[model samples]
Target chain A: MSNALSVKNLNVSYLGNVALTNVSFQVDEGALVGIIGPNGAGKSTLIKAMMGLIPSETGKVEILGKPIRKTRKEIAYVPQRNDIDWDFPIHVIDAVMIGTYPHLGLFKRPKKQEREWAYQCLERVGMQDYGKRQIGELSGGQQQRVFLARALAQNADIFFLDEPFVGVDVSSENTIMQILKELQKEGKTTLVVHHDLSKANVYFDELILLNKELIAKGEVTDVLEVNTIQKAYGNPLAFMKNEIGVKQA
Target chain B: MNFIEAIIHYEFLQKALITSVMVGIICGVIGCFIILRGMALMGDAISHAVLPGVAISYMLGINFFFGAVITGVLTAIGIGFVSQNSRLKNDTAIGILFTFAFAAGIILITFMKSSTDLYHILFGNVLAVRPSDMWVTLVIGILVIAGVYFFYKELLVTSFDPTMASAYGLSTKLVHYLLMTMLTMVTVASLQTVGIVLVVAMLITPAATAYLLTDRLWVMIYLASGFGVVASVIGLYFSFMYNLSSGATIVLVSTLLFITVFLFSPRHGFIRKVIKSRKRASLAN
Candidate 1:
């Protein structure tokens, strides 16, 4: 019923070129929200700015009615898969353990309790068996699942995933979506930067359409309208009509 | 005297052995993070940049460690500033700044007309390592080792994924600068054993060898340090026996170890991949 994340007048630029402009939206607690846009639509940039991963030119991000800095521990973010160096020497479980870092802080080591919780998080994603495998050794879907397990281990109130399904397989995608739905049922807010428009309506309780700015933000049916999709994507998607039940104008 | 007897009887040999081993351990530890972060070139840059600092310290009648660390950190910041401010890539920045610093060092040393000290500084003579320098290396070894152990999590996260680290409110830049400071100290400590030119070898080769041998980071750290010690001990023996340069010999030994592991490591080795694919081809028949 209450807003879990609120971004007001967000503006971001890359090398003096605008990446995102005047983007603003609010995500309610216990909702799975999908951000959909064309390529280079600044979907990832929007999420990064909200998480304060990259500097935003002008914006205000509040999580749980507090500034992001004060509520950092309550937010979990899984960056795009390509942003990671797959060959880095780390075990699946150890990578998942990094999710506990926000809770562990500087000097404290992860105790047995934290380790068990990390393992449990892995179990939640059905990746408990792959704990000892090298992260790079896994298939793309398994790698994404492992990352999702790590974010689950964070125990954060809100989750943001950037293009999680980009290279993922169907089974892992289903597994990830199921886990995300479970998180929503547990009253956690989740915002996913999704590339597949076909699954957008099914996966998210709400949708935020973006194209360097906020085009639409509301229920799936409302935001997936033909006019809004054309505005954000710059073309009428003939395939989207059947996909989302969008009546052609 | 034989090597063991020399080590037992001569205090200079004892100092050299201890100092070289300490350098080995710390370089091995720090080098794991360095290579993992793909900053091996940065390692090389910091090591060379210390030359001007060493020259300045000699002129000032002070310990070169202080001067070397200051310059190393400065070079790091300078590289960062250049690459961030300009269109030049990170390697370009490193190359520009380190060469300038190294050239400045050569000119300073030339002005001092101390070719003998320059030879030892350029090509380290661990045999001539002083007791005070030995103590400095030991202290630095402890500090570097302790710093890594205490900040292992932070380093792991930042090196593995900076975006996640920053999102978690861990200051990735702070960790980077902190690692650079530790690297400067390690380079300064290694000067009497490996010298600036060869120190990056000690930092990278042993860790890379360990990388081929393990998938887990902690295992790699331990194995890398173990390889570093083995190379130091054997290299010192060979250098002492053959009347060769200690720094060059040590670097060569680490390189040999890397080659051996590259060929034979069980999981990620060249030979193993060849054998497995050959077996798979035969199985198809």
Candidate 2:
């Protein structure tokens, strides 16, 4: 497969707690990869480690065939719902504008073009009317959409979404999946820490199963077997992932 | 209020007004972040920590503002670094630093044999504020507000969704430190009159009350500044008329506003409204 992202021997920890260890995986360009694992299995940590948000003990993460540190312009992120304080005072448009911060560089603020692009991103997410609204007033699904809009505005070649589908209705999910598929066509790869095996066939082309380390990774058709699922969530015979995992049925 | 008479007769009041406005705008700008991140109490801790810096600086015969600024920045950085590095809860860290700093300040004050301009430094004689300090606050406020607005997008996204922000290659830590630095500067600038003890009220109350009113950051900034201006005028009058401590009175007045909004604000308080709304919906249905 055409490679868009590559990780090797990745290890990350927080406050002395080991979250991910010796993790390695790859994402093909234009591929929609779903990351599946049990709660605290290092799905979120893996993404954070890639972005250098969490200090990685040992690892190399390359995005678009370059190290993540230098290739930031080509990547974007969508955090979980609980990761943000909804009570924060900001408009949806302002939230979307953050996706362009790196592009603006330090000390320089978002300009008019950036503002318009943020507005356009909100429109793409079906939140045009909500651009001026406070972020807290929106529903959970609406908030998720706003975050998606932010990622869209980033205009990156790759996107890292923690969980972009919780509280979303079926129609909204379809809309988001459509956008993801469209992004693939434009050579924009996406990796989602997704939960909801019910729609794995429709939403993901590849699956990365991790539990402290990579349990499995490859096309969904081969990697999502009953045994693999069991091993990925070995704590219980059947247990879902944690809040860090995206619920995307 | 004639032009010539206004300049000379009301010169002291004029200087006080100008100083208060500058402080209000700075607080409003930086307070926006403090309220958004739930770090309201942390502002209080850092402002109080400046007390010791002031004492030390006075003892060393340096500009008091120099000590105040040094302590404010150091306190902010220490809080940021420790919180980021360790498992210590924010409230505990703030409490530990704030109490010790204030205590050290009081000890220094006790031992000083020379006349101490403690009141001038703490409560602030607005009439005595030099033009240079006024200019510094104005420039700092402008720069800070510009930074806040410029990085508006990054700040908003990071504050709202750190996981997403980090994933997008936006360093939430960088934005966090930026916001804290701005808050520290604003706290230092506002120290002119609000004093260390209650300067935090100036930082938190206006924004908190504005939070009860609106959800948008732009609206929040405007409303918070408006509330700050109102509280300042009212607090000053109350202080001047009744001979109360200006700083303490201003803080109390702000607290009163916060309580009133907490109980009666229409959108924020859902628990009380739920019962009423349920009854109304049932009657209508």
Candidate 3:
């Protein structure tokens, strides 16, 4: 299988303080990968740098064998929940329509086909009924689902989600994970920044453990070893409990 | 003479009326984006910072529009530079640069001994608006409106979620600077109607009122522009009838509209929310 994403020697600094240092990893095509880390591990920073949303000290990121600038249409990114202003006076469907902007470019408005496709994306995420509703009127889980619908509307090959599960309900979490798995089966690559270690093993096919640097990158079994977990988290006790839970399941 | 007859009979009044309405429309349209992007203070800053440019233009016998736009854009870039390079926040930078430009303008005007011109620029006398000033406002009004109409999507996406906008390879910085340029033009165009001191009110109040009345950006823009026109027309009438400061009267009318929406808007109003909760409580009882 070919690699859908390749990162080499990625470094990022926030206000002169080092956020990520010498980090590098590759994501195989159609693979469902989770980025696991402790607090302040630069998980979000790494993804931001890869997308070129922020200035990176040094790095190279290629999507589908092309630089990000050349292949932007094939990529979709969902930033953290708090990164958005929930009360920005936008309808649910209009927010989804924003996903089409990468393809629409400039001057041309979203036509009937684009609008129908946006509605279909909402239906896939079970938010079809909320098209006319204000974005801020929804619950946390519904908001996350709406955002996922927006990403789905992009119809991209590689998806980057930053903490999509944070503040989300169990049903919404399951819905999001199910959609992500479906995307993978369709030969798309997805990288998720996940906070819940208990579900990391079950949720992802591969794991990239990080702590200001790349600690491990391999199958879940290889990356979740005691030594590796300890290196990344400093204390494996909490992770060990989750590990036992995973084993029992 | 009554306001309408005066407008019909006197060309100066006609120019004042047209100029005031155009200012209303442009300020309303641009103000929606400004408030959405949380740049209302930037509106105030640019409006004040243009004073020095106006004074310089008067001294050089050139059009004040050129001078005002240059100083306004400079102040905007200066604020962005200071906040980006240092720990000082945006508001601090805005406060520092705007006041400096405004004080410099006052000194220049004093040196030129143009106290009456200073009064008109600061307080705005629409009755004294010249034909040239009227034409300039009309041209700027068309440009500002066309800019918003053509770039609505770009402005919407960037203002709503800049991170997402940038991730999609859209140049948020470019859009921001473009909006800033439009804002400077709008501020300069408004000088003949609202002047510098109350121009921010025209830029923010009508848009804020519209914000409370809609859930979509396009709707907000339309409603804001409508509210701006209503306020300008009515304020002009009151100013002419009562012999008051035209700029101050227009700003007050816009503020009154905002207060009315704040208290009574159907969906997002303070009073409506309170009434709904009270009804729910009564039903429980």
Candidate 4:
């Protein structure tokens, strides 16, 4: 009952071609878990399936010990940057206000309190001054911060972010990490689909290493060892190690 | 001797003017969503697909509005089903369905005999708009505007980011279908003023021009509606004076405005980019 997330025997496919197979894991409340894998490893697919964003033939996902539909508002997800149309005609404030929309229900516009709250969320991401600017005009880093601000505005207990660091500046990465840590301190559970192997060790308390199937899952130190990484990434590490001759040294 | 004073003498001119402006506002408002979602082709597809509905309605001796709305929604759904269920892409689905419907319409028109000119439905004659046609446009115009006002944020969030929209329990799929229905309604409403061949242009051009001019979506919608009204009025004027096709004239005017914005928009236009780049080059020197 205390678990923030639980997945059992989850299987997903696209047009009968299996994308994920028998993925199972559980995370306690307030845990910072990283879902890491190689490209085409269903890293995004797994999180999406658990969140019921994609249909699964057979699976069970419990959020905060309740069915996903019942607790939908308690969960927030940020898709990959590339998944969004950056040229969309909207302002930063407009983008952030979307976070408050689900709660506003249909037929009601965002009020003054919601506007101030959206602005406060922007301030948390250091984007308060950029509120009036068009979203498309923002840099990659600033755009990611805007998404973070939106997620902050959602005020959800469980967060799912897919590659929040991809194509972003180093400072933005640091800022996102800081925000994730802050979310953890607030006892919010976060699951980030991260692709960067180098940062995995420092970024997560628990790592779910996957390559279409779960290769390893547990504490970062336990799951991100050389063997587990090699298992998930395959023989590339051997080539990388020989080429660099550094990890072996 | 003035154009407005002269036109006021004729009831047909007044009806045409009212119908054109109503179509303008509806198409303009809904067109903003179509443009923002990059569903212009969908708008085109629905517009083209409604032809058979008009013909069928003529054959049934019923109001073409109901028939057109039914056919438009059906075609939209069929397009969605094909794109989602099969390997065929969206444009391919749209192409297959709209053309088939259009061809069926052409064939059906050969069989049906009525006062409704097939030519007018194909290329609208706004001057020929009857009082009933004007009333249809009025009702549909009010419905489309009210829909946008009520569901503004849902459409905004869903169009911008469906992932986030669904995460927030907005039912992105439902929102999408709602938008398609709205598009169909707009296309059906515009059938009298722009005709099927030119309805998509009315739906896309004014909104695109507005996009080039503004960053905020509400402002874009308002500007697009303004542009739509302007184009309709001027196009009506020219069509009245020169005896040109009203639908084509309206579409052409909107296109001209879009091109002007594309070339000269201070924020995102080609000329602005050129000016900024030239300044940077001079600074480098």
Residue-wise lDDT of candidate 4 within B183-204, one digit each (tens)? 8878777777788999999989
lDDT per model, in order? 0.92, 0.76, 0.90, 0.88
Score chain B of candidate 3 by TM-score: 0.97
**Clashing residue pairs, candidate 4?**
none
Ranking by DockQ: 1, 3, 4, 2
TM-score-sorted candidate list, best first? 1, 3, 4, 2
lDDT tens string, model 2, B234-272? 665565557677677667777788788777888785555
DockQ of 3: 0.80
Number of the top-ranking candidate, with lDDT as the measure: 1
Give the CAPRI class of candidate 4. Answer: medium
lDDT of 1 by residue, A1-249 (tens): 998989999999988889999988888889899999899999999988888987998999999999999998898998889999999989999999999999888889998898899999999989999999899999999999999999999999999999999889999999999999999999999999998888788899899998888899999989888999999889878876886777566
* CA RMSD (A), model 2: 4.5
Deviation in Å, model 2, residue A27 alpha carbon: 1.6
Candidate 2, position B51, lDDT: 77
TM-score per candidate = 0.98, 0.87, 0.97, 0.96
Q: State the lDDT of candidate 3 residue by residue for B1-285, as single tens digits.
A: 777788889888888899988999999999999999999999999999999999899889999999999988898999999999889999999999999999998998898796888998988898899999998998889999888888898999999888888888889988988898899999888887888899999999999999999999999999999999999988888888899999989989999999999999999999999999999999999
List RMSD in Å for every model shown.
Answer: 1.2, 4.5, 1.8, 2.3
Clashing pairs in 2: A77-B168, A79-B164
- Docking quality tier of model 1: high
